[model samples]
Target chain A: MNQVIETILQHRSIRKFEDRPLSDEQIRTIVECAQAASTSSFIQAYSIIGVKNKETKRKLAELAGNQSYVEHNGHFFVFCADLHRHEIVGEMENVDLSSALESTEKFMVALIDTALAAQNAVIAAESMGLGVCYIGGLRNNLPEVCELLKVPKRVIPLFGIAVGYPAQNPDKKPRLPFHHVYHEETYQQDRSELENQLKQYNETISSYYKNRTNGERQDTWTRQMANMLSKQVRMYMKEFVESKGFNLK
Target chain B: MNQVIETILQHRSIRKFEDRPLSDEQIRTIVECAQAASTSSFIQAYSIIGVKNKETKRKLAELAGNQSYVEHNGHFFVFCADLHRHEIVGEMENVDLSSALESTEKFMVALIDTALAAQNAVIAAESMGLGVCYIGGLRNNLPEVCELLKVPKRVIPLFGIAVGYPAQNPDKKPRLPFHHVYHEETYQQDRSELENQLKQYNETISSYYKNRTNGERQDTWTRQMANMLSKQVRMYMKEFVESKGFNLK
Candidate 1:
């Protein structure tokens, strides 16, 4: 494999980071890489907020479900789905765009744009010999995060990336089997066939957790998904996104 | 910049491609890189469908708003946000996961997961000297796409990627100014300041289009956005996603 694919294949989230801040050059390069990602229809419906203030990072870490790495990272960058700029374009051009901006289509575009950019940023950080973790936990208290980050309407803070030098190397978490996630021509609809693949994967995952925790935990992927999916977590996301003036119609 | 960062920064959507099919090894490596992307909470809520049949590609190209490259590319991959696997897991475990699976939170997770994986696939393709374009036009007719692809419930085909050897090398479209897209800790709130930045970018984009089209086309970014956003497009996306058992809550 080439160096680029090797970097991608070797990726594992790093939670424990060394107590060192990224240089200005590193931060610039990462964000620039983010900007280089493809934007849908060239709308560029996203923004990046670099959080450098320690107090702000501390509060953000707390707000992101008490994820300590968020506060201790070399730098924290929040990726936001931002159509606020589009709204400004509307005002400047004296055209009403509220209907289009509020459409679920645009909201999906913004979310996809933000995500593509964030992944590039993560890859850039990793290539620089830095480690990164996506802080989806930030969505746990998004309204408060909006207030803390001074995020405006038509702009939703989707997630953050905690980037820093690595303090510890974690084992790569095994992914689903190739055939299980990849289909040719059409989706594999046979339940029995799918279950067979998953059953084998369930063992692989259970053994992974068991070995990682020294037999303390032996959870299968299915159980983890079942437990996580059975709960009504973040039930307010719809209302929250609507509050930011997205997905109105 | 390193090779990976360089690969990212040089990205541009390729519409014209040579009539060459990718080898089996190339497809496998690209999909493997996609699976290596970081999934939210290890949910792995996505799937990649490789379309090899000529008739299927032709129909998909028509379905995706007549994007000819989609049918002409070396390979076509549809990235889907899939929670159907979790639904199966729930059945196997005899636990109800309808609440979580139907929630907007899970839908967003699936969407994010799909985008991250797609970006990785695109990057991998680019690194291997292949050109790729994201086919958001697939959303033009979601129901038809679902029917044609035989996509089941709890799975939404978000977008497709057309990867092939490049036949054209177009100039990179200029993005928004760095400061305008990147904020320190909070979103910049001054309209005048923001407008000023946009106005300068407008000139840059207008010039790019003018040069590219030999003065036949010269549209500012703001005008382009205003025109696009003034009209309602893809009004059926929300309902379409809901019908697919996503964003139901």
Candidate 2:
């Protein structure tokens, strides 16, 4: 594989960092790389909030299930799915984006566009030997997150990334089998060997957790997912999303 | 800048392709790189369907607003935001994921995870001297497209990517300026300097479109957004999402 592919395939989420801050130049280049990602219909439809204030990070850390790395890292950024910029820019040009701004399609567009950009930033940070972790737990307290960030209507934080020099190297997590994730021509409903393949996968994951050095949870993939997905983990997110002015009707 | 960062920063949507199909090994590598992308809570909530049959491609091309590159390209893959695999596995483990299967949060997670994976695939393709274009037009007729792909419930096709060798090198499109995109500490609402910056940016984009070798159009960024965002594009997507058994509610 080529260098770019190598960098991407070696990807892992970093939750620990050394005692160093990212230079302003590094953050600028990362943001530039983010803007370089493709946007749907040139809408861009996203924004990045860089967090460095000690007090704010502390509160944010508490809100995000107390992920201290969100405050302890070299640099932290909240990637938000934003449509307010388009609204403001449209108003300036004597047009209104109210119709487009209110659709579920545009809502998903903003979220997807932000994700595409953030993934680029993640890859860019990784290429520079910087480690990053995505903090989806930020949504644990969405209203507080919005209040803390001063995020306006039609904008929501999808996730946060903590970037810095690596203080810990986590194992590269295994994924579902290739055949399970990829299909040719169309979807496959009946695979005769899937049961056998999954049995092997369960054993592999069982061993992975068993062999871990820290906080080992001896559980296979299915058991973990069964526990996590058995119920609506974050049901309040629906109401919270609408309360943020997204018409996710 | 390193080669990976350079490659990512210089990305452009390639809609035209040369007369060459990807080798099976190349396709396998691309999908492996995709599987390597980060997933939320190890959900790995996505699947990819590779389409190569000319007739299916022709139908998909029409479904995706007649984007002929989707058919003419050497390889085409539909990236679906899926939870079906998880659902099936849960059934095997005797844990029904009924509640998780219908949450707005999980819905968004699936979409974001799929996009993250697809972006990795894009980078990997670029790293290997390939080209790609994400086809959002597939949502134009979601039900029909899903029918064509045999996509089951809890699996929505987010977008499609057409990959192959480049037949035409499209210019990398310009984006909103760095300051407009990246905010420090928190959101910067002060617009004392934004108007002036936008004016300069408008000129930059005007020249970019005006000087294009193909279908030159003299338009500014704000003006273009104003025109496009005035109406509700893809208004039917909300109902279609619901029809596919995704409670995006």
Best by DockQ: 1
TM-score of each: 0.99, 0.96
Docking class of 1: high
lDDT tens readout by residue for model 1, A1-249: 777898888899999899999998999999999999988889999999999999999999998888899999899999999999999999999999999999989988999999999999989899999999999999999999999989999999998999999999999999999999999999888999999989999999999999999999979999988888777889999999999999888
iRMS, model 2 (angstroms): 1.5
Clashing pairs in 1: none
What are the lDDT scores of the predictions, listed in order?
0.92, 0.86
TM-score of 1: 0.99
**Top TM-score prediction, candidate number:** 1
Instruction: Kindly report, for each predicted structure in the order presented, the TM-score of its chain A compared with the true chain A.
Output: 0.98, 0.94
Regions of candidate 2 where Cα sits further than 4 Å from its true position: A191-196, A213-216, B191-195, B213-216
TM-score of chain B of each: 0.98, 0.94
Q: Per-residue lDDT for B59-99 in model 1, tens only?
A: 99999888899899999999999999999999999999999
**Candidate 1 displacement at residue A93 in angstroms:** 0.9
